[model samples]
Target: MLRIKGTIGDWPVDLSVEMDDADWARLAQNLPTVAVAPSAQVAAQPAAAGPADKLWLAAQDLLRRSGSVEGPELMDELEALAGSTGAAKGLLVRLRHSPKVKIEVRDGVQVFNWVEE
Candidate 1:
């Protein structure tokens, strides 16, 4: 016997199913088999760029689009984009020292500007 109870949208749902041994046996017999290759048998592959690489690219794009943006605001956007505050802060620090980005002060706020070559 299988029972499922849940809510879909604003409506409640209840479902129950009962199967005998023969039904279970038939179902199992019709199921497909999956074959998996052993790790030793698989070919070696080149390493791929990780999430940090992707975040760096995204940070570059965001700066390019905005020309200049406040440091804290940029950090917030990067945090949302990276889904991690630590990652965002790390990227911001990297950007601050990057030759392609220029850090300046406007009024009392630090601003990041994309340096175009």
Candidate 2:
């Protein structure tokens, strides 16, 4: 038996326990659609955390200041807040009703901006 794992590209992932001969053939036979349920997949995704939820709520405060935000000016702030607080970008955008996020440069300072609905 062999264990296989590690990166295929920039993506970080893990694969384990390589099989041979008969075992490989058995797995190959089920490749089309093997023992998977849609509900199981939906359930497997973990629920979002509450603190992260709150942080995003706070980010929305910035959105209220303006319909959008400057990306470059706020990327560090946004990424830091989101990463440290475990907030999801999708959630942030959805909650704030601002999907158009962007960056710009002025007077050598990069600025971040977003459009709100």
Candidate 3:
């Protein structure tokens, strides 16, 4: 697996793409086109909790898909989710504390393999 750590516009973004080195560079070159659009009109109340909700749901989905999602990979995915959603770090910590969990140890490193059915 290849990982790249860097900042995005001083936001201190750490991005990890699934692609190998060559592809990662290609993807990076293609990234400048994306933009964040501001809301058209200011809302009286907070827009919504969609991002936070998505973050938690994604965490659960990653755990539930251990048949295809490896433990280490799940952690990576969760971190990315948290970054994109601005979800509290506590979400990941809480997710890890779920009693119904499955894991494996490799060279003293713990990895999640699946979630309890």
Candidate 4:
């Protein structure tokens, strides 16, 4: 398995690819070769966390700690954490689509629950 984490422009990129030795060898066989002196190699830099990432962590923590919270109440907390209504709503939408979160309507109110894996 190969994991790649980086940013493109302003967007974050995180991906993983699984390849066996034979698959890797096949890929290498199709690629062009270039020779470079050892001194030409450059060290890789780690990707930096952005503000949206910070807010995401906080939002996940909020739901996890609460066990369950009403959607409106969660939005209020997210708004404070993100410092803007749009940003908070964006986070809410992200949570709605996340595999670890579950949303249900109870008494006509939407509730978000963090599912433990």
lDDT agreement with native, every candidate: 0.66, 0.44, 0.47, 0.67
* Residues 1-117 of candidate 2: C-alpha lDDT, one tens digit per residue: 434468879987676664555663353233222222224323444565233334444455554455445544354455554553223333333432334545457677644455454
Candidate 3 or 4, higher lDDT? 4
Q: Indicate the TM-score of model 1.
A: 0.57
**Per-residue lDDT of model 3, residues 1-117, tens digit only:** 334577788777666545454653343333212122223222222557344333444456556655534445666766565553223234444454555555567777666544555
The lDDT of model 2 is 0.44
Expressed as tens digits, the lDDT of each residue in 1-117 for candidate 4 is 556689999999999877675754454343322221112111121236333444465667778889899999999988876667876776676677667899999999999999988
Tally clashing residue pairs in candidate 4. Answer: 0
Model 3 TM-score is 0.41
Candidate topping lDDT: 4
Model 2 regions more than 4 Å off: 1-49, 66-68, 83-117
lDDT of 2 at 117: 49
lDDT of 1 at 41: 12
- Per-residue lDDT, model 2, residue 97, is 31
Q: TM-score each candidate.
A: 0.57, 0.31, 0.41, 0.59
Off by over 4 Å in 1: 1-47
Q: What tens-digit string does per-residue lDDT give for candidate 1 at 2-87?
A: 45689999999998777665654454343332222213212232236333444455667778889999999999987776666766
